[model samples]
Target: MTHPFGFNYGGKTHYFVFDSESGSLHNVDYVTFLCVKNRLSIPFEGGEAEDFRALEKEEIDEINAELDQLASQGVLDSPCTVTQKKKRTGEIKALCLHICHDCNLRCRYCFADEGTYRTADKAHMPVEVGLRAVDFLIANSGKRKSLEIDFFGGEPLMNMTTVKAVVEYARSLEASTGKTFSFTMTTNCLLLNEENRKWLNDNMYNVVLSIDGRREIHNAVRKTPSGADAFDVILNNALEFRKIRGDKSYYVRGTFTAKNLDFCNDVLYLNDCGFDQISMEPVVTDLPDLQIKKEHLPVIFKEYEKLAAAYIDRRKNKDTWFNFFHFMYDLEGGPCVVKRLTGCGSGCEYLAVTPRGDIYPCHQFAERKPYKMGNVLQGVSYDRNVSDVFAGNIVTNKPDCTDCPAKYYCSGGCVANNLNFAGDMNKPYDISCAMMRKRFELSLAIAAIEACEG
Candidate 1:
C-alpha cells in the first residue's frame, strides 16, 4: 500500500504529509505529524517522544480519531495502484538538432569530448541536411500544429549559417503546413557576434547560454582551444545577448560538479550577473575525481537547502526575484498524465539528430552507436523490440521507481542518464534519484512556506 509520506520540515515551523499519488499536501500539528509519519494505526508516542510534548491518553485518542477520519476520507495512508501504459508510437513533438559536432572551447568534462564526439575531427551539419531535417520534422509532426526544434551541439554557433537556413526553411513551410515552428538554441557565446546576435534575438524563441557560475568555476573547465580563459568573452557576449533578447525567453544555464559543492553561490552569482532565468545542473560524468560520490550526498543536500532558502527569500522580494529552473515546480498544474508516464519522451517523441543525420534518444545519448535509433533521412527506425521497450519504460514498470514518492515529479528520471550509468534505461542512477528526492522534498516545503507567508 502506498501511504502518505510525512516529514517534519520547515525549520521546525511546520510538518507536512505529502500524498504522492493524489498530489495532496497536508500541514499537521506535531502530534498528527508523528501519527502519520510513523504510520501508526493507534496514536502512540515513541520516536521524537523526548522532543515532542508528553501526550495524555485522551489526546492520543483524539489524534487517532482524526487519523481514522483522514484515512476514511482517503486523504492519509491511502492505497495506490498504477497500471502500466500500453506500448504505442506517438507523433514527434521536439528534436534536438546537433548543428555542429565541434566547439571553439575545450571543456575538460565535456561529454561530447570537446565537440568531436570522440571523432578524429570536428564536423558541421550541411545546409542540405538541415533543410531535410526541417522537412522531416514537418512531415512526421502528424496532426501536431506546434513543433519545436533546438539547435544543439558541441557549439551550434560553429555552423550558424545552417542554423539560420533551417529556421528560414521551417518558417516558410509553416503557413502551408498549418504548423507553428519555435526555435531554440544552446551556445557557448564564443561566436555570438553582433550579426548573429541580432538574427537570433529576432528569430529564436528561446536561447540557452552556457556559463558555469563564477569566473573561477567557469574558467576552470570551459576555456579556449589555446588554453586561455574565455570567461570574460563569454560573459560579455551573454550579457549583450540578454540585453537584446528583450522579453524573449532565455536561460543562463550552468553545470556544477563535485568541485563546487557550494554551488548555491554560483546560482546567486548568475542572478547577480542580471540573468534572472537560471539553471544549475549537476554534471554527469565518469571522471573519478569529478563524479559526485555517495559521501557527497550530505553536502549536496545542504547546498540544495541553502539554495532553496535563498530562492524563497528572493521570491519574497519583487525587485530581487529570479527563477531557478530546478526549484520551479507547479503543484496545482503540471505535465500531462502521458508525460508523467513516459518521462521525457526520449527515444520516442523527442529525438536528437547528429550532424551526420544519425538519431539518438537525446543529446546525451548522441554519438553512442548502440542508441542510434535511425537517421533523419529515413526518420526513426526503432525496431519493434526497441520501440516496445521505450514505450513501456514508465515509472510503474521500473522496480526502483514503483514506490518512490518523487516518481510522478521526476517521471522516471532521464532515460539517457539511466542507460549511460545503470546500463538499463528503466533503472535510475541511485545518486541522482536521491538528489532528486531531496529537491522534491525541499520544493514542497518551500511551497508550504510560501502559502503560509501569503
Candidate 2:
C-alpha cells in the first residue's frame, strides 16, 4: 500500500507519497497517503486542485462548489489527489529517553506522584535499554536528518551511569551510521560537579536546570532531600557550569507555584546571576491548589503582565535576558506556520521513552500508564485516540471557545493541565482560561506597538 501525506498549501490540500528510493512523489488518496506512512488517515473536505485532469469540467466545477461551501463553513482546505513524493515518516528527529524514574527532591508539586511509580520495573534504565533505544533511533535515520537525545528523569543524573552509557552508545551509533546525535539533559542541578561539567562541556551537551527564582523564594519550596537549602548549591553549580561551558545556551526552567507568584521580580534577578535563557511554566495541577484560588486569577495575571512588561523594558536597556516574553516580543509580525502555533511539538512530532522502555505520548504523560501508547521493545506505533487527547480535542470544540477572539492563540490550553485539574483531559478550567486571555491581550498590545512604530 502506498503511504499518503497531505499538507495545506495556498489554502488547499496538496497530497503526496513517500518515494523511499528516488525521493520521488506519487499521487494517492489523502487517507491512503496518511495510512501508508502509518499516520492518521483523515481526508480534507474542501478546496479546488490546480488541475482536474481526472474529471470533466462540470465535475471539477461541482467539486469546486462543494469546496466553496465547506470554506463558507470555516473549512477551507480540501485534499487533492496528486502524485508527489515527500519525506518519509520513519525518521527520528527527537528521542526523549527516560533514564531514571526516581527523583531525589520531592517538590510540593510533582505529577509523577499522582501515578504509580513503584510498579515500574528498572527504577533506572540499564545501559542495555539505552543502547536499544539509540539503536532504534539510528535505524530510522533515513526519515530523520538530525537526531537529538534528551535525558529526562525523576532526576536523570541520579543514574549517571545510564546517561554516560546512552551518550557513548549514541556517539557510537553516529560514528557507524554517519548520523548526527545531539544531547541535552533536564536536571535539578544538584548533581552537577566539576567532573560532570567538564564532560558535558567537552561533549557540547545542552543543560536545563530547575530554579524557581532567588534564594528565599527558591529555597522556600525547592528543598533538598535533606530538607536543607537547595538554592545555594543549585545556583552555585549553575553559575560555575556556565563559566565552564562558556556559552549562553544553558537554560533555567522556573516552575511558578501559588507561593512564588508574588515573587515575579525574583525571577528577573537571574540576570544578576549571568543566566540568559529562562523558561517560566505554571505549576502543573490536577486541581486548583489553595494558592491558585479563583480569586487569585486577576492578581496572578496582573503580576505576570507586570513581569513581562518589566522584562521587555529591561531588554530595551539591554540589561537582562528573559526568554519567555522575549520570544513573544520577537514574533510580532511574522507569518506563523501551524506547527509553530502549536507552541510545543509534543505528541505530533515527539514521543517519550520511559526507563522500562514504555513509550508514552510525551514527557508530561509518561507517568500516567493509561496514556502509555506503546513500548520500545515491540517498536512504536501511532494511536489515534491518544493523538486526539493531546490535540486538545477534548476542550477545543467547546461552545465557550468557539467565539473567543483569542481561541487560535490559546490553543485551548494544555492537555496535561486540564487532565490534572478537571480529572478530564478535555475540560477547560478558569486558571488556563484567564491566563490565556491575559497573554493574548498582552501579545496583541505588543503587536500593535510594533505595527505603529513600523
Which candidate gets the maximum lDDT versus the true structure?
1
RMSD (Cα, Å) of model 1: 2.7
lDDT of each: 0.81, 0.62
Which consecutive 10 residues in model 1 have the weakest lDDT in total? 1-10
Deviation of model 1 at 117, angstroms:
1.6
lDDT of 2 by residue, 174-223 (tens): 66677888888888888888887777677646788888887887777667
Instruction: For candidate 1, write residues 1-454 as lDDT tens digits.
Output: 2333333344554667777776667777877676564554434445665544476768778887987887788766666655756534557778899998889999888888888888765789988778878777776677989899999998998888899899989989988999999999999998999888898899999999999999999998888999999999999999999898877899999999998989999999988888889999988889887888889999999899889878888887776789888887786788876767877777667778888887777788788887777676676344445555677777877889867878988988888788879999889999899999888887888777777775
Residue 367's lDDT within candidate 1 is 85
- CA deviation > 4 Å runs, candidate 1: 1-12, 40-49, 86-88, 378-385
Residue 20 displacement in candidate 2 (angstroms): 38
Error of 2 at 133 (Å): 1.4
Q: What is the Cα-based lDDT of residue 233 in candidate 2?
A: 88
Off by more than 4 A, model 2: 1-92, 114-122, 139-142, 175-178, 286-291, 325-329, 332-336, 341-343, 379-401, 404-410, 444-454
